[model samples]
Target: MPTAATVPYKPANRCIYLHGFASSPRSRKAVYLKDRFAKTGIKLEIPDLNQGDFTHLTLTRQITQTAALFNNFNIPITLIGSSFGGLTSAWLAEKYTQVQKLILLAPAFGFPSSWFHKFPQAELKQWQESGYKDIYHYGKDKLLPLHYEFLRDGNQYDTNKLKRSLPTIIIHGKNDDVVPIEVSHQYISSHSTAKLIALDSDHGLNDVQEIIWQEIQDFC
Candidate 1:
């Protein structure tokens, strides 16, 4: 992906692009989606989740912040989110009928247990004792501390409660290590309106942006 890109004029109907954990609004994917939408005269909102605060970083807080930004706009939205952002998007669509369409890119759903299990006993114990652990921040080019509360907050949300009414599509990497494709499958099993497209890729799925972008165009 390009290091940077330019965004043009805004449009009435907007789309929100929520980045993943330890990511930023300036991420390449975020800007790519922003620049792409700008060409179609559709606005994109990419908020700063960290915003100088990492002590209370969690899915609930992120979702609240995103909802606040989304509420400012009166128009309906096409919600697109990556990883943890995708999980947030799913929750938002469950509560708000204004979300006209929803698209998840390798969404991090049902990962509370998966997260805890991924780490060994010693590492998990360390994370619990310290209350936080440093993870790579792709935007800042360094390791940033993420509070353990992030996982705790994620666990509280039951994905099975998702409302099956809205039109939603999930694109997941079959080889995703962070969030498995089976999680998305579980999400799809609940809703007939939901569709899952499993691609032969990894967690990033950066290699198939063209195909995913085409699907996004077709979806809208």
Candidate 2:
């Protein structure tokens, strides 16, 4: 990943980059993309999705927070979201017409439900019964206590509800263990205006940032 100081500057275009779950604006991918956009003289607005409180994080909060950024612009803006943020972007685009374009990276299409199968039945039950579960926070480099309300809130969002069609591109890793590429495949099948670019990488997609950038350039 490129290590460069994030220089504050005026934005040449209306573009927002939303980081993944348990991540901050300073994530490697966020910083890398910020640097790339800076090189193009474009300032990418990255909001700290954590909101200084990851324990109480939920998808609804992410959507509400990100929506506030472009709500009053009264103009179309592009959105780039990764993982859980990607899911948030899709929901935002569905609800708000201001989101004109979307660039999703390994979007968590089927989330809380998909997660049910990943963990053991006993573990899932314990999480619900205990009211909280400890998840490894990538940005903090430690396990953090996440409230069970997160899962409860996520259940309200169904990927099947996404019916809005706009200029959208999804870049997903073929070997993604977190959110499977099949999810993107299913997503593309429904939306006629969306396309999928499967790459040879994992969930992080760090090794293929250049390729991702190139795709973004072409898409934009």
Candidate 3:
């Protein structure tokens, strides 16, 4: 039998990365984090929430799908979620005690209430009546059809109130147009244990990749 000191080493922690809406494991941010963290003996798991079924993609369904993957971790895990994925991570962080920390990037929390106002009243009415509407997916480079049910699902998960005691770090851009910096501020205000890092970049935050990497490395 081999002595404990001579045994092969194993990483004690896991990293589960949840991608944003309409995005996949192939997203630039996901790949970048994977490459950076791999050198430290950490491999990230990025799940495809859509699972080849975009028609039924809702925030609730995505949460369920992501939870399944996260629940399998027997050791402590750090969750890194971006945009819509950030919202999903909130729900998981609230439910799973195995998660040690949450890192959210421009989380699209508190968005539904404001987004509904973006479309004209007539367009909104038509979408509601039609049951489904086409929306452009930047990650996929294709127009995806989403149902109104997604909004109904979004209403159920309030990121501000979920796991308010969980340790969290939020990285948000001051110039974010999609989710807005105010929302992230509000989230941090409500969650006493959460910290916010405000940057001058846009929602993409591509310009500050090195900074983000350093923060993550420090946190891990």
Candidate 4:
């Protein structure tokens, strides 16, 4: 993480970077934003939110922490949340008036309620009793246990309510499996102020840093 300069200065624009679940502020996107904004003297704050166990903290706790972090800053804030962070950002933007701009990257539209619906109550109980240890393999990345429960809890935070008539940008990959691009389209269609940008990359969009930065610059 980059240290904030000690110079007594006010930023022209204030931005908050929210990393995905199980991810930290040291993520590539957070690092990229920090480096990009350093040259322009813009303040970008990325706070650590992972509390050891994902299931231990509730969604309200996450939202409260995020809101408190923003409350400490005295400037017009723009939130950029990726994946699970994106869902949290949407909730914050809807609840907070200081959030002037929002940028969501591959945000989950809804929870995996349908998939879990098929499981019997006994099976679900057994799964939960087993510590919810479900390993998910995504290419070379291995997701740990309790992630499914996190997603299940994440479903309670409704994304549809966050569709406000405010300046919003939804950047999603066309081939994103984690979060379908159609969700972005649906969000844009529902909100008149939202703009959807479709990219040819995957959910991470790790290869198109420059393009993402340019889009953010334009929107900001």
lDDT of 2 at 110: 83
Q: How many residue pairs clash in each candidate?
A: 0, 0, 0, 0
What local lDDT score does residue 204 receive in model 1, on the 0 to 100 scale? 83
Where does candidate 3 clash, by residue pair?
Answer: none
Model 1 error, position 186 (Å) = 1.3
**Per-residue CA lDDT of candidate 3, range 1-220, in tens?**
1111221223576788888888888888888888888887778888887788776788878878876765444566678999988888887777766666899999988757765877898998888899898988767889999888887777776665674456689999999988898988888877888899999989888888888899887766
Across 120-201, the per-residue lDDT of candidate 4 in tens digits comes to 8787777767757454423225665653455456567666666556688988999887677887887888899888989998
User: Of models 2 and 4, which has the larger lDDT?
Assistant: 2
Model 2 agreement with the true structure over 23-100: per-residue lDDT tens digits: 888898999999999999888999999998899999999999987786444446789999999999999888877677
User: Evaluated with lDDT, which candidate comes out highest?
Assistant: 2
> In candidate 1, how many Å is residue 213 off?
1.4
- Model 3 CA lDDT for position 170: 94
Off by over 4 Å in 3: 1-11, 71-73
Which digits, one per residue and each the tens of the lDDT, describe model 1 over residues 47-66? 88886786568888987887
Instruction: Find the 10 residues in a row with the least total lDDT in model 1.
Output: 1-10
From the highest lDDT down, the ranking of the candidates is 2, 1, 3, 4
